[model samples]
Target chain A: MDLFIQLTLTGLTNGAILAMAALGFVLIFKASDVINFAQGEFLLIGAYVTFAMLAQLGLHWTLGLLLTLGVAVALGVAVERLVLRPMIGEPIISVIMVTIGLSSLLKALVSAIWGNQPKAFPPFIPSQPVKILGATVGEDRLWAIVIAIFMLGIFSVFFRRSREGIAMRAVADDQQAALSMGISVKKIFAWAWSIAAATAAIGGALVANIVGVGPELAGFGLRVFPVVILGGLDSIPGAIIGGVVIGLLEAYTGGYIGQGLNQVLPFIVLILILMIRPYGLFGQEIIERV
Target chain B: MLTLNNIEVIYNEVILVLKGMSLQVPEGKIVGLLGSNGAGKSTTLKAISGLLKPEDGEVTDGSIKFMGEAIHHKDAAEIVRMGIFQVMEGRRVFEHLTAEENLLAGGYTRRERDLSSDLEMVYSYFPRLKERRHQTAGYLSGGEQQMLAIGRALMAQPRLMLLDEPSLGLAPMLVLEIFGIIKRINQEQGTTILLVEQNANLTLGVADYAYIMENGRIVLEGYPEDLRQNADVREFYLGLTEVGQRKSYRDVKHYKRRKRWLS
Candidate 1:
């Protein structure tokens, strides 16, 4: 019972972080129909920038987080304006290739600036463990889960009630229809990028606190891909549910099945989901009739 | 008032579609643009509404002035802000949105205006839209979709509404019903309208003035009654033959080959 409770708490923490990362991926894909392969790089940059502010400059944790988010938003907007804007009408394959190329470029840039070695992430959250349902878990992991859920709740309300949020949904529904209704499709695209960056930054910072900052942080992007695919690329709620399911699967498999099995389980689930239900659990089935 | 002067349009910088087409739509009048398929009627509407640029098409020459100011360089959103809205061909509603939300989207440019009243006003015009206000627009029948499309446009409080092929693919009774509502919208709102259609009989019935276009240029222009009385227009557009004429196919082909409009 203790082992099961411990694994469940750990799974929840990891799932929360994965949900945050997948939220960014889903937002970009939903709004612009671009599979942003550079999403992981956004998280890497966020983690490193936050680490630099806190560890190197000895800034307060709150100030470091704010600065990291600011930089993330600016980076997102700049990337959209400079790289993605010109590729708007290009073929889908070319756009995907551009994003793939962007991911490599970002990884190389981060390595050049910070060096290839891993740097210790200074402890911002307290190191004490919290007892939950008779199972002790790291306080930072508990905090991360709370923060991720909080952000998800905020985004759900924003997408549901906010005027700009509805406009974004309208654009996703039909670009020409949105444009005809006087909604600026360009503005919505920029908003989507910025929002994705901001969420990824929070996820990155939290993950860096768990594991030391390094180029390996970019691997989180690859890991989150399966989560988003499992959830439904365009469904926000699906991201959360998929994240938790994958997290639990990993925790159980890693606990009992063997070493390295947790890492491989998500992809297996992804392939199975793709074959059985291509749209994911909650994705809207796109029906196109001639 | 809107005026197009010797405007020329080309697709992909080649293949000229509109060749020196010029027309004037006076304020507070419903002007019909009548043409057969491939005659550039829809292209003209697109040029006026500034939707041509996105399709790899551009108005290559001349100027379009809306309310006596040159608006040829403005984008679609900018033109919409200037109080001209186009109901695109084929009823392009946001299929995923409810009818009410679709109407709200029409008021996107005019965010400061009270939308609830406009929603009520739209419902008043098309009561069917009111009944299906909560239903997703994709599920609505063809005629209801057309009403929703027009109602969505009216929510913008447009000074000029450009409707393209409003009667296309609809049954005759539904076409008349929609046309009746179109006329009522113009009369009640005093909104100037530029209506494009291939349904000459119905268009002429409601239009205050009519322009007949062929091969991207205006071939004839007059009041509806004048066009209705003309023997050529009656025979070709209205499908009415001269008394006991029974013209042979050869004669009809010869007449088309050497049309007076071509001269």
Candidate 2:
């Protein structure tokens, strides 16, 4: 029972991080229909920028986090304007390939600046373990879970009440209709990219505090593909639920069954879900009758 | 007031759709544009509202002036912000959004105005929309969707409303009901209107002035009563041929060959 509790906590923590990353993916896909292969690099950039601020520049953790988010927003806007704008009206496959190229470019740029070595993130949170219901959990993990949930709540409210958020949903529903309603589709696309980058940066910063910051940090993007797919690519709540489910599955399987099963389990579940429900658990099913 | 002078629209820079088309819509009047399919009625509306550019269509040789300002070069959002709204054909509501949310989105440009009053006004005009305010737009019946589309446009507080085929695919009773409401909106709000429709008799009944378009040109223009009295218009558009005389196919073909308007 103790072992089960410990594994569940660990799973929930990891799931929260994955949910944060998957939220970014879902936002970009919903607004612009781009798969955003460079999403993981946004996380890496966030982690490294935060690391530089906190460790090398000697800034406080709060200030470093804020600066990292600002940088992420700037990067996101620049990418949309410089790289993606010209590719509008291009084939979907070409646009997707462009994102894949962008991902490789970002990775190479990060490596060129920081080198390929992993660096320890400064301990922003204390290393002490907290006891919860007779099971011990790391303090940083608990903080991560709380922060992730808070960000998700903020996003939900924004979509429901804010004018810009509602406009984004309108664009996602129908671009031509949105334009007719005086909503600028181009502006919405830029904002979506910016918000997605900001969220990915925050997710990266959180994950970096756990695993040491390195090139491998970008691999979190690849791991999150299954989460978004399972949740429904366009649904925000689906991202959280899918993340938690995948996280728990990994924890339980890897804890009791075998050593390497966690790494392969998410893909297996992804395939199963795809076969059963191609639109995803919460995705809007497209109905067309001839 | 709206005016189009010698406008020519071309698709793909080659296929000419509207050739030197021109028309005038007086302020605070309902003007009807009657045409068969592919006669460029919708294209003319799109040109005035700046929607032609999206479909790779462009006004190559004309100018559109809205309230004395040249507006052919403006963006769609800019045109909409300037108070010209097109309730597009096929009732293009945001399917995922609720009916009320759809109205709120239409009021997007009028963010500074009191949206609640405007929303209330729309609800009053189309009570069916208010009843289905929380339902997704896609699930609404065809007649309800049309009401929602017009109500959505009304939320814009438009000076000039361009309605394209409001009667399309609707039953005759529903069409009469919708058109009755449209006439009320024009009379009550004093909103200028350019109504495009294939149902010529219905449109002419509500219009103070009417234009008949064929092959992208205005072939005839008059008051509704005058057009209804003209023998050619009565036969071709009003579907009344020679007072109970059943015209043979040969007579119809001959009439087309010798169409007075074409000549």
Query: Candidate 2 at residue B109, lDDT?
Result: 86
Query: DockQ scores for all the models shown?
Result: 0.57, 0.62
Task: lDDT for model 1, please.
Answer: 0.88
Measured with C-alpha atoms, the lDDT of residue A281 in candidate 1 is 90
Candidate 1 residue pairs in clash (backbone atoms < 3 Å): none
Candidate 2 docking quality: incorrect, acceptable, medium or high = medium
RMSD of each: 2.0, 1.6
Per-residue lDDT of candidate 2, residues B141-249 (tens digit):
8899899989989988899999999999899999999999999999999999999999989999999999999998899999999999998788778888878788887
lDDT, candidate 1, B74-132, per-residue tens: 88889899999999899987776788878888888886746788889999988889899
Kindly give the number of clashing pairs for every candidate. 0, 0
lDDT of 2 by residue, A50-163 (tens): 888888898999988899999999998999898888886677688889999999999999999889999998868765799998899889899888988898898889777667
Top-DockQ structure, candidate number:
2
> Could you give the DockQ of candidate 2?
0.62
List native contact recovery per candidate, as a fraction of 1: 0.46, 0.53
TM-score of each: 0.95, 0.97
